[model samples]
Target: MSYKAIYTYAWDLQEAGVPAAVDEFRRLGLDTVTVAGSYHAGKFLRPRGTRGKVYFPEDGTVYFHADPARYGTIQPLANSLLAEGDVLGELTRSDMATNVWLVLLHNTRLGMAHPESVVRNAFGDPYFYNLCPSAPDARAYAVALASDVTERYPVSGISLEAPGWTPYAHGFHHEFALLKSNAWLENLLGLCFCEHCLASAERAGIDARRLKAQIASDIEAYLESGIDYPADMAEAFWRADLAGDFELQSFLDFRCGVVTSLVGEIRDAVRADATVSVIPSVARPTAGAWYEGSDLPALAQTAGIIEACFYEASAERVSADLFDLQRRLRGAGKLRGILRPSYPDLASKTEFLGAVQALRNGGVEEVAFYNWGFLPQDNLAWIGDAMRELG
Candidate 1:
């Protein structure tokens, strides 16, 4: 049978009651419920929330109970609601298969607490939201979190999000930028030159100091020039620019090596029964993965599955993305596509069904929706309708 699932949050299930939510999921023709196990803070406007319309999650917390002994310099804080009762534990008890959605290496609370362990750009500006994967404590914390949840709960699998470097344009609280932002500028600013990163690159035979100095100099020159790079040509320009720079390309590859190794460690740590999957990049079109150090082919070997977030508007775009990703993966591992069936992606049931059809036609057997809390009642109906029609 084809696998179908819905991405959701534990808070949403708790609000609707676990049994009721399970029934609703089944009603929507979903076989799995992917709930947030560990996540960063977000101001979510819950359309289906009964208690309130807007909810702000506690920053950098886990929904499941985490064992303190399993952690290191960085530790996870349990969501206060976990004190009332374990939402994840309750979900695991249900007939529906449960998958833990873990946002690793992107914790603002932990990053701020351990500034030395976070990602620092070429100019030494620390991104408090992104914990450098090369840091020993960060790696340890990620592995422990993955293993701890799988060991305690009988989850079918774990979906790893933000397991690699995050880009510069992430939606931070009141993020303000007056200068015209382009891909080249963001990528340069997002490059991590932290102590751990530098040491890792050095060990891998890269001239870490010289590379950092060159990057800093180039960024300074770009800023001084005030070049208004066209948005259409930005990505192409960046790639061509990287092609000419061998040292920079090697550094990016080293970064991917860092992420791939960390994922392999997490895979080894988790229970043997649970499948490991990585959401390679949150970037659209999926090709922008390298900017965040997510190499699809490398991750395909390390991870059991690659959950590509195809957050596009039309079926044509979705098909094009699927084709490109499959070509890149070269059949190394299983590929799954995630689609948003709500506004800005799929406006009607026909569009949602078309996207599903596009994936199915592209040889993707598993399809997952974005979230249960964010979608409206009609969108849920559209999902059920799509599932039935496809089956």
Candidate 2:
């Protein structure tokens, strides 16, 4: 379909209220809105007097009863703006396809509260903000969240973000220093050895403890000597020597399997009415996509759409990124380009149009803006103008 959508948070609906916001979108000639169904903490809509971390507010989920029993407390935000019956239904009546955007794993509250469910590094230090995909409780939590959203809303699509395990240096405060101190070593350091993950490897007949110790020793040696570390982490993976390390290779495959299982579970849980999609995190030109455990071909079997992000400062670079994403997807699924409508690339009307054109040329069937609450009215209006130009 001719889908032109924008990404919005629940707070955006709260700020302008549903009626006014819907009118603004229609006035801008947009056909769909990918609203954040579940989210993490952010400063979105702060200018409109909205504040603090919010969870499960707009989502009408009672949550799995086992959630609170298994983990001390399960609390989601209440008094949500979309709690009203008419808000989302109104979008549907207005012929606006509502796409529910769920942030799957990067939840600060869940990650901080349940350390056992989060990622553990080679040193066994838990990264409290990124969930481990191998954790049954964590995967169940995600599936429950997805099922709740799909069951509650008459959504046209469901977009899953951060569904895989996060990489090292994600929540760590020493990212810059770590980058300077053998960044490739940081890749080796980030491998998870959590109990759940270890058990998974052991089930596959791989010696988990021995592999972890070897990885730790290698990382430490690289950090101390700054020698023998591959200049690029991506190259290290493809090198024949790493392939010889069966345990290391198995661990990599295991990570991908965990992510695939979770994504597949969510896809199966959600009703067939809503299209399921995933946004895999990849820092361009890097094999970080695979490192993030998103096997595109595998995920495509369940996820019908792949929402590729095109957040570059230059329109030309935006085109390049979209092209790169298209190549990676390899017809695995439909592509939807997500753009940032702010300075540099979208500073002028021509630039904004150029970005849209680039996405279109890259074979993106649809396009969506990054956020409604984060930018100014001028930027929002730019989207309207750009749509008119495309027409």
Candidate 3:
């Protein structure tokens, strides 16, 4: 595998274009990059949870957004994706050390055109937001979007931001819900009782109704006790609220299968050696609720890389932990760390460099920084210098 340091995404530069940023990255020591998002790329995360918004993805694994739209479709946003690819390709052509990773935003115009594909919530209410991967239109949209990526620019490959799982099973109005919900900043995600989800469970050999009954009983018990139970119990009660592990795992497996399967299909669409990868949540659900439900065994068969996503500015321990999580995957050593440079978490030059050192020390082969535009130029310059100096 290549031991390259990459920036996760090109942060939106409303004023400065992608070409400028890519040029700067080449000068900065960035040999590889995985563009995080461009223009309302996060549109698909609706019915949002406490984390504000998931960008897009109100639905579960199979569902897609009702509509697909890109952010800032004006001159800058319009040409942003291609511009970045062009610049990234320039770096690659100039020197094999540089590369690009393209991704389809879940909430783009492509997602809007296919709402039925988005996941339906517990109330049979689908978030008018998010893209549903299970819908036929989703495949069509992806094929077209991905084709544009592989065909148009100098993209080395593309990867999607990791999909999150909501373990809390209360109501779509539940506290953890992220997008398309009444609350955008709570820790409450409800149990999904939508017919499609139930049917999916049933198809997985589970009796969905039984699971609902369990959830009801657990909730009643928890309510009668009048205590804040552990997240694990809350989750077990919630999932049992829907069905049994057989069905839950079955649902999880099916959902995870959808993503990995897409990876396979995407592999067919891009360059034969174009790498296909997924960024999954670092940990597993203790209560087996919901989160990035990746099938590592299955993923190992197709994915060329694995990424651990988290906001930048995390503790060094977090950087080490990210490295550890990647290590546990089937490829063991072929793991990369993804860091987002969002607000309230702007990593400093020292902090970013420390993060890189920690991950390298932890045995991570590749480290990616988030959004290029938002980060201070000096930071990238520092990173470039560090990458050249680091072993």
* CA lDDT of every candidate: 0.89, 0.71, 0.48
Candidate 2 error regions (>4 Å)? 44-94, 172-182, 223-246, 285-287, 344-348
The number of residue pairs in model 3 that clash at the backbone is: 69
TM-score of 1: 0.97
* Span of ten consecutive residues with least summed lDDT in model 3: 58-67
- Give RMSD to native, each candidate: 1.3, 4.5, 8.1
lDDT of 3 at 322: 58
The residue-by-residue lDDT of candidate 2 on 1-391, one tens digit each, is 4568888765556556767877788898898888866666532343333554332242222211112322223343332343444455555555678888877777666777778888888888888767778888788878877777677667787889888877665653324564353445556766789999899989988899999888878676756874554457545644653568887777788888889889999988888777888887644532356788887667766687777677677688887777666667677878777888886346666677788888777767588887777667778888888788778
Query: Per-residue lDDT tens digits of candidate 1, residues 1-391?
Result: 3458899988888889999999998998899989999999899988889999999999999999889999998989889898788888998899899999999988999999999999999989889999999999999999999999999899999999998889989835788877788888788888899999999999999998898998899889878896877887877878887989888888999999999999999999999989888999978889878778888988988988999998988888888999999999999889988999988887777778899999999999898999899998988889899889877
Model 3 bad stretches (over 4 Å): 1-20, 36-105, 108-112, 162-200, 209-246, 282-290, 310-315, 330-333, 340-350
**What is the lDDT, from 0 to 100, of the residue 282 in candidate 2?**
43
* Cα lDDT, model 1, residue 290: 74
Better model by lDDT: candidate 1 vs candidate 2 = 1
Model 3 accuracy (lDDT, Cα): 0.48
TM-score of each: 0.97, 0.83, 0.66
